[model samples]
Target: MFKSRRPGLVRRLWRSRVVTESDGHSGKLHRHEQRSMTHTDTAPGLTGEAGDLTEGAEREDEEQPDDDRGAMCVPEHRGSRRGQESDSRTVTCCLFGEWDFRPRSSYWAARKDGAGPCQCAPRRGVLEEDLASTAHAFLKRLKERSLDALVKAVETKGGIPGECVMVPNTELRLGAHHISPYYLLCKLFRWGDLPLSARLKPLCHCQSFGAVDSAKVCCNPHHYSRLCGPESPPPPYSLSRSDEHKPLDTGTSIGSVTSGGHRSHWCSVAYWEQRTRVGRLYPAYEPSLSIFYDLPQGTGLCLHGHHRHGGSSSSSVQQIRSKIGFGIVLSRELDGVWVYNRSQHPVFVHSPTLDPPSARGLNVKRVMPGFSLKVFDYECSSWMAEHSVKPESQEGPWDPHSVRISFAKGWGPCYSRQFITSCPCWLEVLLNNHR
Candidate 1:
């Protein structure tokens, strides 16, 4: 029946039937809802079928799990992604090649906290300021202990030959050799055996015939002239009656000058003596060996023993029964000192002057008992002019040129200040003066 009806009548009947069915289930649909439904119904026909769309959606859900598993397996990818995000915020600062600078929020806030990018630099500057202040205070205090005051104090309290005394609350430790103010006063003064204290007497100048007094006079000629009388006119006086009254030959040799004419005889003698004294105090060349010890020789030896009868027998017994300490054997051919530890215990040796060039900066050495160590090649000369002492003259062919050794309760180098108070032992070597 519907097919036989008119086509327009059939379409109108179908639309009326759909509208009537929708109105029976619920109220009339809103204009927006109706439009969305129309679009959904036509979208599949233009793009794909509903079954195809559902299948694609299910494949996408399954691929998400695989992607999550891959991300879990390779954590670096995730970290790189995070790093990229962080780097996007970072601003690099190009200073020097060594510096890695990044501007952080905290860096910008540093000005509020009174700090800089390099906080340690400011802290170090503060520390330096504190050190400078401390050093200034120390120097100020040191200036209070004047040399004149120190000399007066030492004169009031005489010191022993090897003893050392430190200024109270100071780092200055002065030895007996440094107890004189004259050395500090003289511009050309050098260290020598002739101490200023030995020339304190008024007559010491006259007794030494001006040789000793000239040093004092040369240092302060005007000051000494007032104390020891006017300087004697240069050697031979004029034959004139007025000049003859002056005893110009009092301190000089009579033969040094002739009565016929004036000569600088006393001045020449004085100059020679001064030069000799200086040469004796400081030699031009260094000796082959220098000996140093803390204890006296023959200290631990059994000199008066029953085995002292035969020379060979005594030597053999002494080797077996002698108490161990230290001994040295110096050979002229070797041009060095062979130091041995005679003690059963180990001994440590330290010689800044004698250390070998190949020692790789090592200065201290240890030696076992019955072992010998050679040191200081003969070719080496002393570069330390201030510490070197001239060799003393001795009457032996095999004797060393110079020897200086010190000892303490234990092993180590003995400082000059501690030499007296540290149970010190000493050894000295005297060599032929001609060398």
Candidate 2:
């Protein structure tokens, strides 16, 4: 399980190629191993372990010819979400053993860590949106146009990220954390494996003007073109400001989650941020070239840090508890600054004026080492108490504020003058002022 954290493991998984006959017996063995382990049980005894696995392997060997027969064929329901509309239709595969739909080696490692096999859950929202018709089609489009579109978009909107910002897989991530759209797009499009003809130019560039002018900038113009257009609006959700330790609900519609054995959902109260389900994207532009580049700088809105391209700047605020601390990261790449807790356990942020009981909390859990769960209780807790606002009376969704960024300068303390709700520059200044 710890191996998953190693960059080498990920690189190896990403580097594997499709097994073919040219490789002879070893290739056949590997293919058989992949097929057989896709979903075997992992309870204990050899039958539950090795024996069942072998039977599955044999079955796969028998089925290999059928796959070869239809090697060029496409599965019937490859990229769809048409039928299963109800909660009952949300099918979850039983916790599969390590081999479930993966090569034997992957199965062994995953089983050891107890990570459940990937399910066929109608694909996630971002994927569905990107591959609206088909994953293959989406890949084709990305290959055909995303790079050009990204280049053109960056030429227009300066917010485009460059080579410096890391893009993670196609999952929602926060600005304060590592991971960026560049990483996701490359993985999804198999950009790394493609020949030079298919490779897109790196988006990073030198600033044309500013004090840090010529400073290297991360820009994916194609995607950025769509972002700053009038069509894009702030995501329609906001989370409570404090750490509330809410349980994750298994049910959909209501936001809840599972941890260890306990399950808790965010409070039924529909806060603004939670309303915008993190990790989802809407088609943001009307596909254009000039419009993408002509847009003003700083028009790119923050995704409250929940964007595929985690933003670029580290937070200006850092509050240290004896054991834990919290900080906010702001990036011109994203609109809202991210409020992240450095604590292993849940740390609360609150308004100073509020009474203790009235404040809300944003409970956090460790998703990755150094990264904690981004959502929590609605209370304005201690984390925010040092800021100018009195903690007790600060009812959140946090109060809306504006930011003023200098196009030539990029971003600064003055950016807070504008009314962007997601960035916590005010809190940073408030704490700095007190200090």
Q: Compared with the true structure, what per-residue lDDT tens digits does model 2 show for residues 231-320?
A: 212222221322111111111111223566544421111111211223332221211001011223323223234322343333221111
TM-score computed on alpha carbons, candidate 2:
0.22
Query: What lDDT score is found at residue 10 in candidate 2?
Result: 26
lDDT of 1 by residue, 32-115 (tens): 111111111211111111111222222232232221122111112111223344433322111111111244522111222222
Q: Model 1 scores what on Cα lDDT?
A: 0.24
Model 2 is weakest, by summed lDDT over 10 consecutive residues, at 284-293
On a 0 to 100 scale, what is the lDDT of residue 158 in model 2? 28
